[model samples]
Structure formats: structure tokens, C-alpha cells
Target: MIGKLSMGAGAVGAISYCYYDKKATDGNGEKAVRGELLYSNEVFITKLPNTHLHLQYLAAQYHQVAQLNTKTEKFIWHQTFNFPPGENVSNETMVKIACDFAREFGFEHNQYLVFRHRDKPHEHFHIIANRINANGQNTATDRKNYERIQLFCREMENKYGLQVTKSKQKSYAQSSSVQADKLRKLIDKHLPTCQTLSELSIALKKQDVIMYLGRGISFTDRNSGVTFKGSALSRHYSRSQIESRLGKSLVLQAPNSKQIAISDQSGSKNLNTVIKSKFPSQKESLPVSKMISEHNNATETRKDLAKINESLRSVKNRKVKRRIN
Candidate 1:
């Protein structure tokens, strides 16, 4: 399951859309009746005539209590929880999860609405919550709120045996940069087992990719007419990082070569020799030593971050295990 929390300034606009299914469809055959409003709380009137008005009245109550009517308070906290395809979840279960999420984020005392829409391919529900709590104070909504949502989703996944997924922000925000990161993972997977530049080149070639080491290093996607610099993909996939693992002396004799040679003693000399002899058109674009120094620092920073994350995960796992025990 994936959860996404968004803050909005208008409660009326958001609540009206979810409450009335205002994105109404043309009445025809199967499209005529999409789905009825799933469920509502007893504290509010669910009838069409009074639902929106009642919600508006609740918002007015909060405004009166706070003694300030500000439209820019981000009074709406909208969240969507989506389930994997082929998973049939009931409205009761969804409402329970949605309520749990709201309560966990300190929204238990606030008035909210849950709508299960079957218009999408996957089973998903929308939650429209008031930002104001029962005490008329603004609910806590910040970066840490997102982290809490992520943790709550993980717990729900374990409890209900749902498909484990990364939080919505991390999963969706990185969609555009996924191709480069995938290339980095591919390099990390194949480069370590390769002892020579030639063997590494052959392994990468099998994957329909060409890694070039002329004046600099880069990976060319065979399927797409796209080129990514070594460091551009990731610091871990930097030219120096590749060379440090595969060997600093490794050089691609030619992009089409079936095999290349490796040497420990004449590594750097042979690299320069191959670049000059085979790929004379390409010249050293950037200082290799300087690039390596920068990437080395990045590598260390990444290592530190990994250690911290691992420590946190371990603590979380232990806490979960203790609860289970």
C-alpha cells in the first residue's frame, strides 16, 4: 500500500469534490452509476441536501473558535491510500485504516470524510480531513508527518499482509530519475565481479549497454538514444568508483571491441596508449584526479548516510519484534 498526504488551503473545495463526486460522469449504461458514497460519520449529516453545508458549518465553528478567519491556513489535509491491483479490500477495512492513520497523525479529534472510489483500476480511498483539531488548534502537518505516514503504512502492510511499498513521496518523486539510478544499480551489480576492463565491457554489452572511457567515462543506453555521465548517474557510479572496483588501468580499446587487455604494471600507461591509439577523436575533457577526489568525498558521505539508515531500520525492526513477542 502507498499513502500520500497533501495539504490544501480550501476545505470547501476539497470536501465538496469528494462528498458529491463533483467530477460527475455522463449518465449512460455502465458509466451511469459509478459508485455511491461509501460511508460517513454519525456526527455529521450524510444527506445530499445537508452534507456540504454541515461540513462548511464545522469549518465555521473552527474559525469562530480560533477568532481568526484565514483562508490561507491550509485548512484541508487530503490523503489517499492505494492498494495493489487484484487486491479486494472492503469499505469497513479501508475506513478502519484511514481512521487509524488520522489518529496516528493527531487527527483523531478532527472531523473527516472517507470516500472509496471504484473508478480507478486499483482499489483506493480518499480521506478529506480538517486541519483544525477539536481544541480549535491547527493539526501538526509537516515533513515529520510524512515520515509518520510511511511508518504507519509499513505497520499496516505487516498487519494486513498487503504488498510492501515505499512511501508515495519517495516512490513518485524519484520516478523521473529512476533510469539513471537503475544504471547505477546495474553497474554496482556487474562491476564488482569483473576483474578486467574487457570482461566488464563484455558483461555490460550483454545487457545491451556500452560504457565508454575516452577523456571521461559514460554509459550509453542502446535502446534509448541517451548518454549519462558516470558521476551524473550517481557518485557511486563515478568513473573513479568504477575504476577503483574494476581497476584504474582499465580502458575500452574501442566501443565495438570484443575483448580488451588489462595490466597491473603498465595500467595508466596502457590506458593512455589505448586512448591515443584507438579513440584519438576523444580527448581528456576533465581532470580525472580532480573528479575522483570529488566523488571520493561523495562516496564517504553516502557511506555515512547508509550507516545511519541501517541503524534506524535495526531499531525499528527490534521494536516491531518486541511487540510481536
Candidate 2:
């Protein structure tokens, strides 16, 4: 199940239109507000108010109930249904399931306004809830709230026999790297034909390839290997896209003199010196000679040490003989 939390503020007008039913007459003989037509795109399943304004109001009330004055009160945590089309669960059932989950997660005080938005291809619901609990206590909405919501979603899916999409847990960095790899391949394929960064930008735009520009050239897709002149790409693409694609560019100014060093005798000698210093001697026996020299030196040192020790022992033996005489 995919779940996202959104805070809705300044939507009082939208909320107020949900509860006004035009067909129903008011007590004073006034025609009831035609809220149903206004909210044709919205399906309210629970006891919560139908208007977006009322939903926001309830959310604010709950925000107070949860004592979350410092935190934003107008919020919606959206969850997608795990059930397949064959299960025949109506959009209303999904909305109710979501509302029940929200209530379980400390949204009990204010009524939850659940609306199934028909704007998208898939059936998704919008849940507006007050952030406060009953008895006017401030509710906590943090990472833990998200985890509990996920747990509840899992349980509900099992109870209703819904197909659940397993979420692959990944750090932001890992996911970003994966995305970068994908973009890099796209960039590499288009880089050669892109004579200028603008041309590259146009090519990428056609492919829906987004990139960020930085000081150093960076490619979003490894395969595309797109090169961006920081200044050129910055004007065409968004800063975020540029930064996201090409990291910061490294600017190096050309030397003023631009003196071309000719490979004359001096240059040749210098080159030879560098090569000789870096490479082994052409003579293969050079290493063997050095090894032999080292071994001889070591043998001589051992012999000298042995001779010294023998001399010391001889002197001690003579002293013992002299003392005995």
C-alpha cells in the first residue's frame, strides 16, 4: 500500500460546497445548496462532512484536540487500496476502510471526510481529518503514525482479501542513485548528436529527461553522457533539474601565454628522464644484480657478527684458563 500525508490549508471554500444539497429545501423555505453536484467527483462514505471547508474545519479541530497547535492541522494521509478489480470492492468500501484506519490512528475526535476523487485513472481517496483527539488532546503525527497506518493497511488488506504491493525499503540515497543510473543511460544515447547543451536540453526535453546543471558536468543517464556547459544549460533547464543531473562543474581557466612546447633536444632529454625514472631498466638482469648485492651484504654482516661473537668467547676461555693456572 502506498500512503502519503498532505496538509490542506486555505481550502475552506472548497470544503463548504460539499455539504450543501440543492435538492433539499431549508427550514426557512430556501432551496438547499446543491452540494451534491459540486461534489460529484467526490464520494463521501462516512459520517464526516461532505464539504472541503467542513473537512478542513474538522481537521483543525482535531489538530487542537491533538494539542498539535505548532504543527499543521489541515492534512490528508492518502492510502491506495490493495484489492484487485475482481474483488468487487466499491470505491466507497475503500474510503470507509481508509477512514477506519485514520480513526484508529488517533483521528477519532473530528469527523473524517473521505472523498474518492475521480480525477485520476486509478481509484484513490482523500481523507481529511482533524489532527486533534477527543477530550481536546493533541494527537501525534510523526513517522510512527505512518508506520501504524501501514500496519493497519496490511491488516485491512488481509481481512478484505486485497492484493498488497510490497514496498521495497530503500534509503533516499539508494533510490536516487538508481534514478541517476536510469537517467544517465538516456543522456549517453543523446550526447553525441547534441553539439551544444541547448541542443542536448531539447533532446532530453523530448525524452522527458530532466537534469540539473552544476559547476562540473554530470550526466543523469550513464549511457547518454550528456555534457552541460553550466551557464548554457542553466538558462534552458531548471536549476533543480541541472543540479539533479550534472553535479557542480569544475571551472579551470586557460593559461594566458598558451606557449606550445616543441619537442626539441631539451624536451626529448626531459621526456627521457621522466620515462627512465618511471619505468624499469631495459636490462632484465638489473634486478638480479641488485638482489645478489643485497644477499652479499647480508652474508658479510652475518659473518662479521659471528666473528665478533667467536672472539668474545675465545677471550673468556683464555681468562678462565689463566685463572685456573
Candidate 3:
């Protein structure tokens, strides 16, 4: 299990996202969806079925508690308990783990929520809490909080007999330049698989990278929230260049089939030349589509030859007329 912690100023916005934020998607770029709410603590009122009305109620409830603390700028305590994939954890256990953290973090009395999110591959839950207790005591301080969470996670793993995650020192050590380079390479690796700009964007979403295309291109690292201009990373990754790379103009068909498929794998080869190269044997073995293409070429060649013969006859007639006159 991994415990990541952060502090925010707004309680309503933080809690609302835990209730309704869509991130997961069906690979075909279909409608994005989010997970459901699992557990709630200190219910002041019943949950409403309508998403908007319930979120409004939650906003009011969190702010009512937040008004107790006017001095603190950041009163939201948000953390996520991330379980490794393939770990079968029950909801009761999940709530118990969240409550344990609440006790440790001193938010047991504050308005907090524990929500299970299925959008991610791993089993994880978000805990959103108002750091201001009922008595208006500011019990939230994020100073070296990550270290505290790591220690707490290790203790939980031992108690629950869950798979232990080896702690690493300063795991988020990659600089922006380093991250941009990594993204640059990833885009290059996936460009061949993409046939259009939209296709490339969809492909990169699975990796948590966003590709923006327009007159100029840019890329965003969803994890780090850093966006890089195409030219900033490398000149080769510019909008027009990447667009040209993804825009496959050649329509390839099978030996005798007319099912057109867009591709750029042939690289600078003309369509007819590619067809002939693939089918070097007798014409009888050629596909219907290729035969039709060859027939058109033959017709054009014959027309050109006939035009040349007409020009030669006209030239001879003009010379004979000049001699007769």
C-alpha cells in the first residue's frame, strides 16, 4: 500500500471531485466515466440521488465546518490509500483503514469522506477531510507529511499482512527537462501506430500524456501538470511535423481487394510502383484492384502514343503543301 498526501484550501471542490470526477475511458475514445462513492462519515443529512443536489449539500456541510477556522488558509486534508493491483480488500476493511488514518492524522472529528475509485488499475480510495475540528483547532500541517504517511503505510501493511511496498527516497526526483525527454521518446514510439492526430491523442491518453494540436503543437504530462511546446522539447516534434507524421495519405489495397486502408509505411513509393513490386508475377495473378489500376495506366499511355503519331502526320502534310505551292 502507498500513502500519498496533499493539502488544499477549498474543501467543497476537493470533496466534490472525490464524488464525481471522470478519468477512466474506453480505449476507443468513447465517453469517460468515474467510480462510485463507497463510505461516508459523520452524516449530517441523508444522501440525495441527484448528483448536483448532493454535491451542493456536501459543499454546504464542509463550508459550515470550515467557517470555524478563519485564520488557516489551507484547511483541506486530502490523501489517497493506493493498494497494489490484485489485492483483494473488502469495503469494511477499506473504511477501517481510512478511520485508522483519520485517528492518526487527528481528523477523526472533522467532516471526512472515504471513497473507492475504480478508474485506476490499482485498488485505491480518497480521503477528503476538513482539517478544522469541531472546536476550530487547526490540526492540519503538511510539513514532511509524505514521510509520516510512508511510515504509517508500512505499519498498516504489517498489521494487515498486505504486500509491502519498498519505500524509496525522494521518488519524485525527475526534473521537468527529464520528464519532457521521456515524453518525447514516448510520442516518437507511438507515432507509427497512429494514423491521425486524434488517434495519436487517444493513444497517449492511456499513458497519461495529452497531445494538443493546432498551428503549433504542445504536450502535457498529466502526472506532473507540466506542458511542453513541441519545439521546446525538440524541433522534430512540432505541430506540423507531427501532424505530417500521423497523416497517412497513401491508400493501400490488397493484391485484388478494394478495401482501402490509409498508411505511410511504404515511404515515398508511388502506388502503381508498389503494386507492381508486390505482384511481379504474371498479370493473371494480380488482384482486381491492381488490374484496374494497371488498365487505366495502359489507356493513358496509348492516348499519349496516338497524339505523337498525329503530330508526325501533320508535320509531313505541311512540308508537302509547302513544296506544291
- Which structure among the candidates has the greatest TM-score? 3
Per-model C-alpha RMSD: 26.6, 17.4, 19.3
Candidate 1 per-residue C-alpha lDDT over 42-124 given as tens digits, one digit per residue, 9 for 90 to 100: 23543335223355764454345334435337767888888888888888789889778877876677667787778778998
Displacement of the residue 259 alpha carbon in candidate 2, Å: 47
- TM-score of each predicted structure versus truth: 0.46, 0.35, 0.48
Local accuracy by lDDT, each model: 0.66, 0.48, 0.73
Clashing residue pairs, backbone N/CA/C < 3 A, model 3: 255-287, 256-287, 256-288
Candidate 2: segments with Cα more than 4 A from true spot: 9-88, 145-147, 168-325
* Model 1 TM-score relative to the real fold: 0.46
Q: Which 10 residues in a row give candidate 2 its minimum summed lDDT?
A: 269-278
Query: How good is model 2 by TM-score?
Result: 0.35
Candidate 3, 35-132: lDDT as tens digits: 45666676464555532326667767777777888998788888888888888787887888898998887888778878888867788889988888
Candidates 1 and 3, the one with greater TM-score: 3
The CA lDDT at 26 in model 2 is: 64
Task: Write the number of the candidate with greater lDDT, choosing between 1 and 2.
Answer: 1
For model 3, the local distance difference test gives 0.73
Clash counts per candidate, in order, are 0, 51, 3
* Sort order, lDDT high to low: 3, 1, 2
